[model samples]
Target: MPESATAAPPLQVSSETAPLRQVVVHTPGEEMALVAPGNKDELLFDDLLFVEEAREEHATLVRLFEAAIGDAGAEGGAVLQLSDLLREAFDGADARESFVEALVELLPERNFEAYEAELKALGPDALHRFALTGQAPFAVSATPLPNLLFTRDLSAVVGDHPILSLAATAARRPESAIIRTIYHHHPRFAAARERLIELPEDVTFEGGDLLVVNERVVMIGQSERTSLGGVLAVARALLDRTSVEHVLMVNLPKERYCMHLDTVFTFADDDTCVVFPPIIEEPRDHVLHIEAGAERGGDGPREFRMRPLPSVREALEEVTGRSYTFIPCGGADPIRQRREQWTDGANLFAVRPGLVVGYARNRATYEALARAGFHVVSADDFLGFYGDAAAASQDRIAVRLSGNELSRGRGGPRCMTMPLVRMRNSES
Candidate 1:
């Protein structure tokens, strides 16, 4: 029998701080090695990564996640590599064809139509390798997808509905296409395929710009990577299809440093989030509230009412009926805040409420988290005590993972992971 026959459970991510059940990540591979100084800018990398160290750092993260979620025996642990899922999706003939066509469409400049048949005939492993490195046995070479390391930008699963991204730049277009194919073909996500929310080709939206505040509210950032149109498109779709009642759109500075929402903001607990003080505390970044209007029948346009909010904190409070604490990325230091936020200080991934993981280099950020009541611990230390009674008794943990090599890719923990299935607060 094929591997897809007994695929993992379907996806269900309703809140950012829920206990993570399953997630998708891509380890740095030859595609990352392909990124050199000369072509680094073109590949959307500020600096070329040392592939081996990056992989080691990412493995530490994977192990941390595995330890937190606990192993699930033969079905694999909580961490799922995007490449492995792609290979499994390729088990189906239809999935292979879909992937080939999507790749061909994504790279029309490559003129892949001529070799379409030959590409589809390749085995799953060969196809996976070709997709990553963009090198085929038949002498065909396309731009490698180095940005695949940041799985969070490809797609986001929000409350059982998968919102597929449309890459804003050509360099990351293949990453979007490949992930869309996985969501559509992977058996674990088969149920989501029916309710998948795909953005229009004319608009650009990366998953990193989105955050699920709760089952009824989602936050999207209109930044360098996600357009205003993309924000509205995703909002309208969520309002129409899912249980989401409010979509808070945050207009971010159109700069590389604030390219995605996760870069400046991420949830650390049910009522807390770490944020760049300049952006969230100051009134520079505008927050707009998009609420679902009266429901309409088939062929009728969905009604969505929009209004401006004082800030993200107010918006969440209004929607969730609860107060929230915004922990500064750097501990009360403006200079340190800028320096740490540049290295993705706010981009922490939550395993469960009060339990998060992020870059160890962000000392100021970790210090801020500690000041905010979180117990900061190194990845190694956390691993040492993990699964023990003492570890289980501790609360508000902030696990620091080494990210010196991985930070070159300009994405931290949240940006490197795409949570698929998560146990909701109520469920937990």
Candidate 2:
């Protein structure tokens, strides 16, 4: 039997609003040191970050995920670190040897024997540290992966399949390989990673630009980080391999403020979405919809119907049979809207059907959410509520986390997280 017909992966993601089950995260490490006082933009970071402060901020985000446990206490959600995954992959001797060989081949020195000896002498944790943060002069100086913590840039999970992207920027290229390695070699994911969408090297895609709103629909953005070719490739893959029938292609401006789709647009709940007015409302975004077409004669290739779409909301309404509420990122002020959108005000990671996590600094954005019936609570308060049996509950809420250091890297909650599993709901 083909690999696609094999045992299903241990995870599934049908919608953006489902309860998150398992996720992969990478914290900022010494690789961040690659950016100095100058040319930070060359590496894709907006500002310098203190490693300790970023780590502390990440812990608070993790607390929100910890509290998102599903129906069973063990099923809600759990955090998995890339370092830990790499360490687990290294436990298998053959995989370890293969990784070392690949590393040596990629390096200019090609000191295979010396590299092998040093790697073998270190423990698993040291191996991750060595590979990621300590490979300064040789492996990652020029191509430092400071943005690896933005795990959402490399992959997007649709149902039981994970589509791995080829990053548009060279700075983020290595992250895809590292994640592919983990999925290929790690025991936990070995069987689960059966179906995948991997585009050609020339095509570029990123998770922040791809959103699986529901099982039958996916939205791929053409932005500074994701190309039109990338969207076509992923759209074809979804049509061929999964239950996805319609693919929405939204063209975003090639600018820094709207770098990714999630930067300017994200689903707030089942019936609402947070968006920058300039992109989703002003008609600046060029839209298209794609679906499978009739097959040709024998020995001929499959065809697709790609046509212009009036707006993404039209198809979404047809799919869900409901009208959506669009909340502006920075309220009604255009100046504040432009400024807040640059800070990732629209990027919110959903914890459940009506719950999400967002940056605390976007005051106007949170104010909009508040007016939309979203109870905005600090990360500490939410965590405290999780520990209390008598805590009052609301219909929906946004657990805000301190994002001073994190936002400096130019990504928000949804950009930092890569959800591997989201428990299925009745509607899902």
Clashes of each: 0, 2
Q: How well does candidate 1 score on lDDT at residue 272?
A: 91
Among these predictions, the greatest TM-score belongs to: 1
Residue pairs in candidate 2 whose N, alpha carbon or C atoms collide under 3 angstroms: 69-76, 70-76
Q: Please give each candidate's TM-score.
A: 0.94, 0.88
- Candidate 1 TM-score versus the reference: 0.94
lDDT of 1 by residue, 1-428 (tens): 25544575767887998778888899989999988888888888999788899999999998888777764311445788888878888878888889889978877877888899999999888888888988778878577888998999999888888888899888888887788888888777766678889888789999999999889989999999999899999999998889898899998889999899999999999899999989887974399999987768888977888889898888889989999999999778899999999999999999888999999999999998888888999999988876543224438899999999999889999999998888753653
lDDT of 2 by residue, 78-183 (tens): 7777766776676666656665655553443435556565555565656666567545333433345788889998788888888886777756665665676677
Worst 10 contiguous positions by lDDT, candidate 2: 1-10
* lDDT of each candidate versus the true structure: 0.86, 0.76
